[model samples]
Target: METLATTEIEEDVDRISHLPDFIIHNILSRIGLWDWIRGGKEHHSQLLRLSVLSKKWFNLTASFPYLIFRIDHFHNVSRLNFFKYVEYATSRFCHHHNHVTAHTFKLSTTLREPAELDIVIKCVELVLNKGVRVLSIDILSVLGVQRYRLPNILSTVSMLESLAINGCYLPSSFMVNALQFKSLIRLKLQYISIDDEVIKYLNTSCPLLQDLEIRRCNGFKIVCVTGHQNLQNVTIAHNTQVERIHIEAPNLSELWLDERRTMQMNLVSCKKLRKVTYFGDLLPNSNSGFLSNFPFVDTLMLDTKCNNLKLSSHSLRTLVLLSNYDLEDIEFRTPNLASMYSRKYLFTMQPSVVSDSTHLKASMHCNPYGYIDATWFQKLRQFLDKKNGLEVLNLHIRTTCSLEKRDLEKLKAIELPPYELEHVQLQLDTQEESSAHRNFVDAVFWCCRPRSLILKSSSPLIDFEEQSDIVKFTHEKLLEQEDQSRTKIQIVPSSSCEAQIHLSDLKSLSKALPSAEQIIKFIKEEA
Candidate 1:
């Protein structure tokens, strides 16, 4: 037995070692640039380990065109040591990949002193001199007084394609034409302090720029994105002091804004703008004609507290409205609307014409301990009655804890109008205990008789053993009470929640609900 085990181990090693060098290189290359350096630290030690495997792997790993050097002085490192480490690593990386072009060079560090700022400038020049195309520099300071002023040689890099700067100030004294980046396509600036002159120079020079994102940035009040023919997408969010925004890009397709405060917006000739998301206050006194500028908008998401909203667009398909205030009236006139998502207290929807929409998603936050208002039944009934054309309905209701047994029974007693939806989804945010979900399922069954019922739990605890008891009890009780012969109930873990946390997908759910499967197996045996 010992001999056989040793032979198997040797054969496995031989299988991997005998593979072609190209296959091994492909496997190592698939590790990706972002994955190679994780946790804001270079994996030079790990790469050295990979070098011991073979001479071919060593050469391939060293020749990687993506050079990432990250330093965080917040972790109790001296400024001199940080500068020396960066300088040595950069020198070695540039020497090793001399023949290859720099695909991406990302340098993220925190610099406080004027001397540290000089080191960053020298490093930037070194990388740019190596034909760097994609560059991202994040220079953060603990004290907010100092800003890393970019070098003048930045504009001279004509081969640059993408530039992202965070917490680094731009050179404000440059000439209007001196800040030209002829081949740049994507620009992202975050937490940077730049005035109107810098914004104007960027708009005038980078005519080929397509995507722009400004987040939590300060210094300029008005942002004018005008006459950029190739500009397609723009996003501005979480800037409290931006009092005005102007856009005249005719070819722009998507615009996203987290409008925390009401700003004077002049959205002019964006004829191709198809998607818009505005999440903040839309006061009555704000720009009235701002939304009407986009004639071809398809998707709109508005989270506003305005009591009355009147919107007219020719080509809208998906609309999401999230308002804390109870909606008195909403006048949405879109002929091509199809999907509607809302988290508002619905009073009435007065769309100028009824849309041919088939999907309706309603989300609400519920405190399990709080008492449910009796008037909610009427409102929910009216909303359901109005959605007769809905073919699919998804309910995302979150609760703090499990419901009491008496309350669950009382909830189950509420009479709900039967819906004939083809597919119904119930997404609940619950803990390990599933009593609330069981009760919620009973209430859902009373309301909608869907062909397929999908129950998804959004919490982290998704153990089959813990969930089996609830599934078995609910299944047995449901079988006894109702003749659900045509309905198929599927208990699935929340796909969206699991995806966000990078959880592995479970394909089959049969083992989790064994009682239900056993009943079907018994019936098959009898036949």
Candidate 2:
């Protein structure tokens, strides 16, 4: 019987080995090699053991198209050993699969010595020579260390399609008269110092470039991208030195600008622009007419302190406003607006949406440092009143003060809205557990009762005891209402699909709930 079992097992292994090359490669790709790199040596050994199955399996593993070398993964090894491991891995892979091209190669490492950078550059060159299509390199070095300069050899890689370089430097000298990237489609540069000349070079040379992202990079004051017919998406964010950006891409669809200070932005002939996310002050004289340039804009996110900004977009679908305390008024004339999200300090002027769309979902985030009285709730109610045809409301509150018993009574006395929302989400961030939590919960129910209530806390310092106290208090309050009204409240863990629990079973299962970020759903069913 043992001999027969051994033969059967061998036969089964042989059958798996005989699978087609593409099937075997597909299976290997789904093994999640990137996830296994974060595990211990035992898990890595298990993955390595797959190579011993057969000569074909060993060769297949050696020729794997995705190569990732993250130095942080080898935390147990010394710096010298880390360098040696990377060198050995790159050389071995290249030697074994010299004829086969890799699909992607990612390298992330901290550079302490100049020699380490040379090794990285050599490895990148080897991969590029092998026609790797997608490459991502992230280098972190000492504060005063010289930044990694882009090698001239990079311009020769015609097969490279997507490239991302972080914490590196791009010199204008390297880009001057450099050859074009015929196949390059996407480029992302972060934490680098690049100038306008390099940007101009890329715009003119790389005809196939579609997506470009420049974040937290200095040295260039003006980004003038003109006549890029193939450019589709552009993002230039958080650059302190950038003063003006002028783009005339006719095919551009999305543009995101998140500058710290005010900058002049000019968009011409971008009739296909669908979304614009601006996080800085608009021009002093700019008003509603500024949006006329983007006639087809579907989504707009403005995070500026510009006061009295009037946004009138007929085709706008989604709108997000994040304002400083200084912002006073914003009037929206978007009749087709579908979603609106606002985050700001309390008492700021809420945006007035004139949309008639019934699918409008509104989210409000308020962080009031002072006490919460009846006035705040009244203001919230008035804000919700302007959103016509509103379906769902999500409210996030972060406050230091809790509603006292006296204030709670005043809040409850206010008349509730006649129409209930389809869903209401309440994310509370408070300091501690207090008697006022119950009052706050009651105040929320008075404002706008919804058929479904989702509750969670966004406080990072909150412990399990505090989270449980809030959950228990909420459950008790909902149960008390269930006894008098026809509404039946069913509690379920939002992260789980298990059977819903009755009100009486909550205390027993309270300890089973996840802490801090746990979300509990309360479905109100009319009996």
Candidate 3:
């Protein structure tokens, strides 16, 4: 036994001697710290065990980054453990250089007071002192006297490009006194008061700012900027004074407005805007009237729960509306249905009513209450003319509650023009009709022969990427659980609201979808 153990030791020594010190160091340095942290909780012991392999391995693995020390989990992880993890990670990555450039720490808790905030600040300082590029803190309120948390984080990180804070309170924050922020590109703040002072400070302090997201925030007179063409997103929410926002971001493509407190949408500016989402109670009062002048249209998401919608756009192709489908109010119009975007409206019916898009594709969403007469579906089919045209379509169908058999059957029987439809979807309440709904999807597929088919039940969304990243993360986490009951995809279902979902379906054939002319023949043959 002693001879056997001695032989094994000699073999291990021979393996270690084959590699130079620099090669061992390089191998250790290449270990991605974030991957280990996110992979699973079981990796903790494995990471530690790797350090015990050999002295060279120990030196390398001990110094590499292995986790993101988020302060929000401090309660669960003691200060001793957090520092230990950090020390272990920093030692591995910054052993020779004394600093790294990729270290990251995230926090999602309200710093109750300076004492509590100081602990986290010290943690940040410890990591930033070494090196950090990205940091996210979800602060309910900065309850500390150390006001310039913003400047502290902004100034400290030399390579920081992304920063985020949740529930920002300016009156209670120390960042109000921050004079100027250095190089920054992406900034996200939810419910963070961007009063005139904050806006002015950002306009001057962070000149190179690019991406900005402010959710549920109030007190905005006007958010007018001239520079920052790289600005891709500018989201403002929960305010009544958005009437004077003069956007100058030539590169901006996504804009979100949540007007729960006020009513004012005048779309005369913003030439580069491509995506627009509006929420809150917008009853179209004098203060917040409907938009009449939109330069163009791109993607529009309307939350009808707030009872406001804008369907006017020359470039409008993708339209999403989140409304209750329980009420029987149904008014759908596509005047620009043929030319580049469809400019004329006609009540004429072709030999058949099922229409398809010959020109640009259309995306629509309907969430409401009550039964829509088959006439609306009839009109839609006629406009589509699937026999002679090709179209790309996406739809989300949802109801507040269950639907009666008659109403459900009507929804299932809905159809579009054949051959022209390239994409189709159905977002339905899974409880009321899961098995029977397959036929509805099948019929549309038979007609349109779409390339992709999305069948979502009990909700209104169809596309996976269309949902919020945070929501996506949550759903993924639920799916990871061992318990199957919690992993199901059935959420809230209601019947009080109207449901309008653009039926999306998948193609059955692997061959490329035929051209319009070829599709016409293909449809005739298939029929």
Candidate 4:
């Protein structure tokens, strides 16, 4: 065994050593901008170790074009040693490749006092002098002093293509114009404050800016994007103090606004806008004129209180509506709409689209009293029947409590339609165990008649044994009906607020179809 292991190790090392230098450099060059930074300090250490492996590996790793310097990793080391280590690493990396330029550089540091902030500023200056196309700086003021300011030298990085800054204060004398940021295409600012002047510069100047994202920021109460030809996508989210927004970008294709605090908005002239997501609570007071400016919008999402939704966008292809209260009436004149997701209105309303098929996803909020009445099923059938072109249906039922066997029996006996459903998903409270809700599972399966059934519980404690009975019962019931053997059943455990489920759990159960230990191993691996 020892001889075999030694031979295998030698073969593996020989295989790697035979790879060409160009192939290795190509692999390293494709490492994404954020991937190296995601590993923190350990990633840089690994690269240093790789450089010492062999002569060829050393040369390839030394010319590495992307680097991230996270100084917080040295918080435990002596200050003198930390500076010496950084100086050695940076000098070695920056001075080795006289011809090759670093494409991306990221710096993350904590500034507890003036001295630390100054050191970080100097480090940024040094990396800038090395010439990088993409730069991201994440500076945190650990003492909450907020004294660290972005240096004015950033404006001189003429070759910069993308810039991102988080948790750093912009100086009051900050000035951005076309000449300063001409090459920048993408800009992201999070947890940073910028005033009206910067907002104006972003809208009128910076012609090459195509994609912009601003999250959890302040310093301006209004955002106006008008008359920009190159800008394509814009996203502004989670700004609590912003009260108003105005957009008149004729060339903009997509816009996303998710600010609950913004009370007013105007999309004056978005003639080429294709998609929009509006998530705000101040819809009742929304300007009707602003809502009418979306004649060319293809996809839209609105969380509004308007009882009557009259959308006349001929190009509208997708629509999603989320509202606290049920809408009384809705009207869509979109001829090309292919999919829609929304809460079912109190009364059945028909859309005026003329598509051959439409994919529909509906959400149902079950009553806390655990009432799954026949009327609810009748209404669903009526809604589906009125929409003749519905090729697929997905139901997301959010139940509040556990259900017993009787509830499943009632659902099985309901006069449900024979229409085929694509998928059915249930969300129950976390405290509700899977073993006690077999009836609820059966009811969803029988009532929806879905091609595939997904059984999800809020509790992670759900085991394979807990769902075996339901699986067996479903199989027995399906066998009683002809041509139902192809239906699929899947089990997943997820929290009420989450949608992700690990596939390993299902794989373990499938390998040993009727065993409890497999499920136990799955859960243990999860823990």
**Would you list the C-alpha lDDT of every candidate in the order shown?**
0.62, 0.71, 0.47, 0.59
Q: Identify the runs in model 1 with alpha carbons over 4 angstroms from their true place.
A: 1-29, 32-47, 53-64, 72-82, 93-101, 113-115, 173-175, 283-290, 327-331, 344-371, 381-527
Descending-TM-score candidate ranking? 2, 1, 4, 3
Candidates 2 and 4 compared: the better one by lDDT is 2
Candidate with the larger TM-score of 3 and 4: 4
Candidate 4: TM-score?
0.60
Best by lDDT: 2
Could you tell me which 10 consecutive residues in candidate 4 have the lowest summed lDDT?
518-527
* Per-residue alpha-carbon lDDT of candidate 2 for residues 394-454, written as tens digits (9 for 90 to 100): 6666677777778778766766663366676677777746456566777777677566778
| TM-score, cand. 2 vs. native | 0.66
Q: For residues 35-55, what per-residue lDDT tens digits would candidate 4 score against the true structure?
A: 333444465766665554444
- What TM-score should be assigned to candidate 1? 0.62
Supply the TM-score for candidate 3: 0.54
Using lDDT, rank the candidates from best to worst. 2, 1, 4, 3
- Model 2, global lDDT: 0.71
Worst 10 residues of 1 by lDDT: 518-527
RMSD per candidate (Å) reads: 11.8, 9.8, 15.7, 12.5
